[model samples]
Target: MPVHQRPFLALGLRLGAALAMSSLYMLVKLVHQMGVSLPEIIFWRQAGALPLLLGWILLRGQMWQLKTTRFKSHATRSLMGMVGMLANFGATILLPLAVATILGFTTPMFAVVLSALFLREKPGRWRGLAVALGFAGVLVIARPGAMPISPIGALVGLASGFMVAVVSIQLRDMGRTETPLSVVFYFSLVGTVLMLPTLPFTMTHHTPLQWAMILAMGSIGTLAQLLLTAALRYGPVSTVVVMDYSSLIWTTLYGWLVFHQMPPASTWLGAPLVVAAGLVIVWRERVRARAAATPPEESAPAGRVPRGR
Candidate 1:
């Protein structure tokens, strides 16, 4: 099947990625609450995932494909990715899971705008409307005028969302020439190396359970990253990323079940608008794909019968 025809598959991968990422965020929150510093958490999240990523590459016998002329791109992506991770993790620590997750939904809005600006993927009228609706839903949920979140946390969360959009555009470009495994592997490797310098300052002894949770963060995170990269590889950035709004469901569940924190009534009120926006994009993409795939009928000469008729 053509790549453009796989929106359903991309949607599934994106939804799975969302679930895995929300779980990772929950773990990050738990570990941070248990006294792990942000730098230490970042280190473990990347470092722990590196070996697993390497093993996956080796298992697929694609180690040789890791070589690329795009190291500069990889470096830029890695740096942006690390900054995004820090802001995302820090937000998770500072805010409620639902709030952080809702804030992250801004990624799709940014992705749509950046895709138009950088990737040159036009946001048609439907997509533009969907992004606008999604943003309105986010405002309803965030309720800046009434919410009690720290201003710094809100800024960091927004930064994370913007960086995520930037990285998604980078990945869309990179995916053209690099295999998904190569992109993910290099990110883990570079992230691990870059974060190593902070170990001396941030490392601390952890109980065995804490260590297990840290490792789990890495494992889940690696899976989420791979799924996300593959989804972008298989679909348009704006279409695939809008699916990330699904993460709010998983994050809300984690917040309720694990942290015993219920989202405000505003969340219930606003979430459907966000979800509806995603559905609009998905429906529009499918329609567009079908229209592209269907060949136009040939016109007959004037006063002449068509060949078959």
Candidate 2:
């Protein structure tokens, strides 16, 4: 493909991926509003998704490619991913879609901070400033005065953020040892297993319509990850990172259309901060890329800790 065409393809793929993910959130919120507990919603949604992924493996004739040498890494990553997605979905149910979406993008910031602390990677001055500013913005979004905080909702978002950071860490380690698709596929499988123990408590009253919604959630989620993976394949990581931010736009629309709910003012104020955090990461990444474009002055670090992809 031509260079110009590549970006256009990426744009379209990101847009579609955004729509799928935002729609999954919207649907989960709808189900929760209809009286499903968070546990029940998570169990059914992920369980429904498993067979669809199985179908994809069969269709692609790549079932053999599902073999993974990094089972423990995938298992750990999947557990964290499960926690992240459940909390994320629950947050969507309790809060405005836009607010949830905006705060959720803080994943990258959390990724940076966690990487620095755990991976012992140092951030340059500008990136450090960006991380601090982003956390202040999180405070703005979580203010006690306006829109009294829901502890469950807040915890959901924060915990999910941390788990997602862990997911990125595992990905970094495992990406070298396994295929990306294999990693993603296994994450979904492990997530379904992690979500299973709750089934007895989760198996509650559900109308047929609700079941359909849950299944749709699973299908959409699988589709969303596929498109996102494809989008990454098509262009620069920075472009895909920027496009990931567009989920807020889709979630905002979905929130209003589905539930007539609008995010609070503080969330609106914090949106720029979240975006700025991602932009900072992207900028730092570009700087690193340019450095890599040059011959190194000395020996390079081994498996250098990366900014959240």
Candidate 3:
């Protein structure tokens, strides 16, 4: 209730939620480092998530709320999500989870540009600068200037960012017609379907412990998303976003301590700028949302009509 500390407190919540999600990413990287194949990783993790997601909805007795009038759009969204997952996982293997996430946060920046170009939504000036800055940050981390680069990790990051943006835009349009539960069900359904083709290709030699880790990856992601949704019900989004900064800290620590994988100093320097780009995008979007929600100022006509004529 203290006014002065509100920003501080809100920051904590978002950071905490972000950290929770980051831990999931860390687990993925660690498991993958143990030499698990991407398809196998995705299969176990996403499959593990499905039952828990359904169970939670069932607990709320909202399972029947699922619908599918926009099957095409739902399928598109899910495909985009699957691609994003692939790129993201590959990035995790190529770089530290924290570094990949910093690169991944470019999603919001991509969303801004994609929304402008495709949806005809005009973003503010700051978002434009953020996009450029984000690219620069990528250059810093990728070392395009001084050394040979595979471009695979960078490409994967960009691809994941792009696909996620498409999915987000799809959701924006899809939201006008689809119920949240319906959309969620479709995402799970389509993702499962798309993932099926790759299932036969996945490494099937995971030990029980690796399977457990994979299961944890999927389960925790679903739970974290749910918890984050719950957390927002109790607190403001700005607080939650700021709290997400904690993910950076947790992921960085997890990547360093557990993996002993450290990035070049240039990467460490650029990461803050990358993260700042995400924060700025989130802040700008929140401000825009608030402005849009505020009713336009009303003015009496030059000549007022009689009331209830």
Candidate 4:
């Protein structure tokens, strides 16, 4: 079946991805509190997911598809993605779940600017306004002068968002030739390899429960990645991307229930603006896609009017 035929399924998958991601963050915080180092956390995240991904690839008889000619591209993407993951996890450790989640929402805004600069894709008026509004929302949430949260956490979260935007741009080019599974597999593999040397310094003793939580965190992270990939495969970008905002709900609930933390008043005030900006960007992209797909009308012959005229 064609992917665009399953918009509702795509939506459900995207929502599931959001939930999984929120759960992963919560678990990361839990394990970190148990004395897990950042490098160990990152290593477990990638190492644990690698086997699951491998099993899925083999079970689907798609191992051959993992072969790629763009080794350098994969390496670059994996490195950037690992940095983004580290920053995101680090932010989760330093900040409340809801605040970290809100900061991560800046990705689309960054993507708008990055796209214009690197991809040479013009943003036009509406998208330009959207980018401005998104940044304004970020300032409202951060509230620099009267900041109550960790400034470092806020900066790290924003860095995560920027790296994610850069990775998104890289994916745009890679997607032309790479399979999603291969992209994911290589990312996991490379991430694990990159984090291996740190094990000697970062690894610590863990109880069975801590070990279980670490594994669970990695498993949930893999699930989120798979769900996100599947969502995009089954739906148009406009339909799927909007569902990313649903993470705000999941993260908020997790923060309140699991961590006993609530978003500040500024989060309540600024979240809507960021969300609205992202939606506006998605809406514009959908409109542009539709326009591009439309065939141009035939011009009237010479000076003669055509048809009803």
Q: Which candidate is the best by TM-score?
A: 4
Tens-digit lDDT string for candidate 3 (107-198):
77787787788888877578877777878888887887575334677788778767756665565466556655566556666777667788
Model 2 spans > 4 angstroms off: 1-15, 148-151, 172-181, 229-239, 297-309
Candidate 2, 1-309: lDDT as tens digits: 222227678778878988898898898889887788888877767677678777877998988768866677777777777877877887887778887777777767777787688789787777788888887777788885565456567667766666655665555455455654676688677766776888787678789998788788878887876676566555555555667788888888887887888877777777788789878887886677666676654325666644432
lDDT of each: 0.82, 0.73, 0.69, 0.84
TM-score of each candidate? Answer: 0.83, 0.84, 0.78, 0.89
Residue 79 Cα positional deviation in candidate 1, in Å, after optimal superposition: 1.5
For residues 20-66, write the lDDT of model 4, one tens digit per residue: 99999999998998899889999999999988888988898888879
TM accuracy, model 1: 0.83
Model 1 C-alpha lDDT per residue in residues 39-150, reported as the tens digit of each score: 9999889888878977877898878768798999999999999999999998898778988887776776676677688778888888899899987887777678786565
Best by lDDT: 4
Instruction: At residue 202, give the lDDT of candidate 3.
Output: 74
| Poorest stretch of ten by lDDT in candidate 1 | 300-309
Winner of 1 and 3 under TM-score: 1
For candidate 4, which ten residues in a row score worst on lDDT? Answer: 300-309
TM-score of 2: 0.84
